[model samples]
Target: MTACKNEQLFNPDIRLATLDDLTALVALEELAFNYDRLSRRSFRRAIMSDGSVLLIAVGAQGLLGYALLHLRQGTRLARLYSLAVASFARGFGIGIRLLKACEQKAINTGKTLLRLEVSALNQVAITLYQKMDYREFGYYHAYYEDQSDAIRMQKPLRHMSVEQSSHPLPWLAQRTPFTCGPVSLQMVLSAFNPNYQATPEDELDIWREATTIFMTAGHGGCHPMGLALAAQKRGLSAKVWLSQEGPLFVDSVRDQLKKAVIERVHYSFMKQCKTEDIPVHYSVMPLAQLITAFDSGALAIILISTFRMDGKKSPHWVVMSGYDEHCILVHDPDFEEKDPNQSPLDCQYMPIARDEFEKMSRFGQRRLQATVVLRAN
Candidate 1:
């Protein structure tokens, strides 16, 4: 299904995939592949996820093909997760149209490279990729569910040479989805003290100590003051800065009892901080002030909404590894890339634009901003 004849360049209208296109895209997924298919659930998430780009091609006959791209946040590379055309529509130029659109979108979004892996058995697709200027870079053994190999190919989205940037911190991926708070803590601690080894057990322990069980979606996530207290108990001096007082993530919970429990936890955390003399500032830390604090030799564990990354309206934590005038460098513990060749460094000290960071730093209708600042005693 990869090869297309140059039969008079069939053009199709392309647009971003939406919820309305879900059923069509799902049917198209079924029509396209036998193994390693994207499910209906995956399509829904990608449609809503901020980290993904899903595009659909529409011709006079309807959805001819679609392409899904994974936008690597903080990196210049974008991965073509999937591309499919209707079985009857394969020989037309639909795949070419979808792929070129992907390249243009990648370039528009600051990605300099578009990478994909095609089954080595499918020389047609590999030929299409090559015709589009994609070069073979690597290969994966048994990369497919059917134990078939894949040939990795990539094409520069832009024609210019751009240098890559790396973060200044040792990187570690969060073992569980809910452990980003602790994983960020673990990374910052590794920077603070080299001999301090991080473990999965410790990650769960810190999560248990800090989680508020606020959201009913899957699991309760860590609280700001709770995270600060957990780290403080571990001997690092800690302070909690918040946008508003009382409780955090109260808006995320629906049941009355759960909200009350969150409030109770917040009160207890405040009282405990008072008793322990740990500083809890009842104000949002301005960017300038945060820069000053960072310059004073402190690492920050900050809360941001996943809406900007995964299109999910929930809280996620990342370490503020460093910052410059234009971009804020961070170590996001939640690494979602599944490609084996992609390294953990992909998410380490990733550069997010300053203005975009400011927008992503807040969550929910109240725009809650919170951070746990850690320092040497």
Candidate 2:
């Protein structure tokens, strides 16, 4: 393989991988991981794919280590798909250099955050990631081919300047499985009125006030209009954005009675919105518009498909707080589990790409898009 011109200042041999290095990459993968190793074909594709960046460290002898970063389509998040160093090269600081190179590549591509999953048992890598400011946000059970658990970690790359700020919104974990909407609303409301106490009681109150009776499963999700009305009830000015102007979530229910209940609840919300003279837009609100609203001090509660974050195809709500050219930051009120080590802040100020935000800002087979913008009157 030809020497890369942009060599590392310290090593003078680290650079982007080319297709010519596929054989070495395969060898390195085999050496580094006995299980969950990338196949030769996968390494070849990664080397050639525009959606990925593979950085390799070389020596006079040949390949020493490599880091592979995968850019998620339509998202500002980049995943460090793999990182490995030859067993002989372990103590030479090659891993850190490869990681830094991957982070730089991600930032150059306008990515704001770098995330990865490492086996929980990999203490050395975990310590290195922590030292580099990567924080564990969550974990995946049996993530590996060998049924090993992996810890999800993330580090912010851009939007770190003091000028880049998130709204002073407090994150509240949903007390119940179906209270994400209410909890998100509570967080935004608390941002407006610091005296507003966001409690589990209030969460259920809001849910009762707003739920559509049935989602894709038990205990219906909140309708955007219902959420808007709930915010209004709490003395906040609200606007509702809907992609379609009909009963929401009705299509997800198979039982006629359940469908009718959902439709009735949705129409009831529409009537309340009308009676209160709330502005309901029957079109998709552009991300730019939502950003503008956020910039103007409006708190946004948005409905999104959880499929991107987790593999679940369910609708969920998150409170949008800030935005930049690279990402839209929000406080997600739902945590999959309660861990003493994981703080609510871990879920707050989470950066999501504008494009991915748009794709995720909808749910279900009908692809329903909805948002509730609120501000203190």
Candidate lDDT values, in order: 0.80, 0.82
> TM-score for all predictions?
0.62, 0.64
TM-score of 1: 0.62
Error of 2 at 19 (Å): 29
Q: What is candidate 1's lDDT per residue for 1-377, written digit by digit as tens?
A: 23332232266678999999999988888877889888888889889887788999886667888999888764555788889888767787789989988988888898766778899999889989999989885677998999999888777555533233333467789888788998988887787788888988888988988888667677788988889888887778999899997788888878999999888888888888888788998899998887778888888999998786657887899988776545676888887677432445456555566778888999999999998999867
**Tens-digit lDDT track of model 2 for 139-239:** 77888888989998888886643234567777789988899999999988888898999977899999999888786677888888989999999999999
lDDT assessment of candidate 2: 0.82
Question: Clash pairs of candidate 1?
Answer: 2-125, 49-310
Candidate 2 regions with alpha-carbon error over 4 angstroms: 1-111, 114-165, 338-343
